[model samples]
Target: MRRGASASHLDAAAAVDAALPAWLGLPNNAEKVLLTLRAARVAATARGVAATALGVAATAPVVAATALATTMAELLQRLFELQEGHKELLQRHEELRQRRM
Candidate 1:
């Protein structure tokens, strides 16, 4: 059971990893953020899948899953914040560059 479950989990992960390049190729900033959110959703799914694959009814996996889900949620939130910060940083850099010109 563990072996088969492990193999299936690995297959799912490989499928997601394989599609990463296409996600990265998105041409627009909004699309990229959407892609990141998609990736985070995949990660959350992966955590649950992994827990189920382990076939453990233990509390540890449950706790871990909760922690992982929270972490992924926080990551998704930060991704948006970081995107805004990045745009601001670029604007400031451009302003400084213009001033020097």
Candidate 2:
């Protein structure tokens, strides 16, 4: 009975091993299929990372342009304020001169 049980277990193991390649849809080359699948996955991951990097690179010019526009607007506002202050000082100086005369 012990010998019979061991023989049955060995037969079962052999059957499973024989069926594995067919179960995985490979023609007696499961290792090749697994390696191909791994390579495909790595290629897909690399493509995704490259696409993200390209998206960031494409947006860089727009970001720089927006920053430059903002800086120019601030500088223009400061220039206008300074011009107003200068006009006011000139008016005050003219008034003082007339009073002295």
User: Positional deviation of 55 in candidate 1, in angstroms?
Assistant: 9.2
- Cα deviation of 11 in candidate 2 (Å)? 99
lDDT of 2 at 85: 69
Candidate 1 yields a Cα-based lDDT of 0.66
Candidate 1 residues 1-101, lDDT tens each? 69999999999898876563436575435545555676677666766665676675435635354665567667767866775676677579879999999
Clashing pairs in 1: none
Clashes of each: 0, 0
Q: List the residue pairs that clash in candidate 2.
A: none
Candidate 2 lowest-lDDT run of ten = 57-66
Q: What value does the lDDT take at residue 25 in candidate 1?
A: 71
- Kindly provide the TM-score of model 2 when superposed on the true structure, using C-alpha atoms: 0.36
Mark the regions of model 2 whose C-alpha exceeds 4 Å error after superposition.
1-65
Q: Per-residue error at 84 for model 2, in Å?
A: 0.6
Q: How far in Å is the alpha carbon of 83 misplaced in model 1?
A: 1.6
lDDT for model 2, please: 0.58
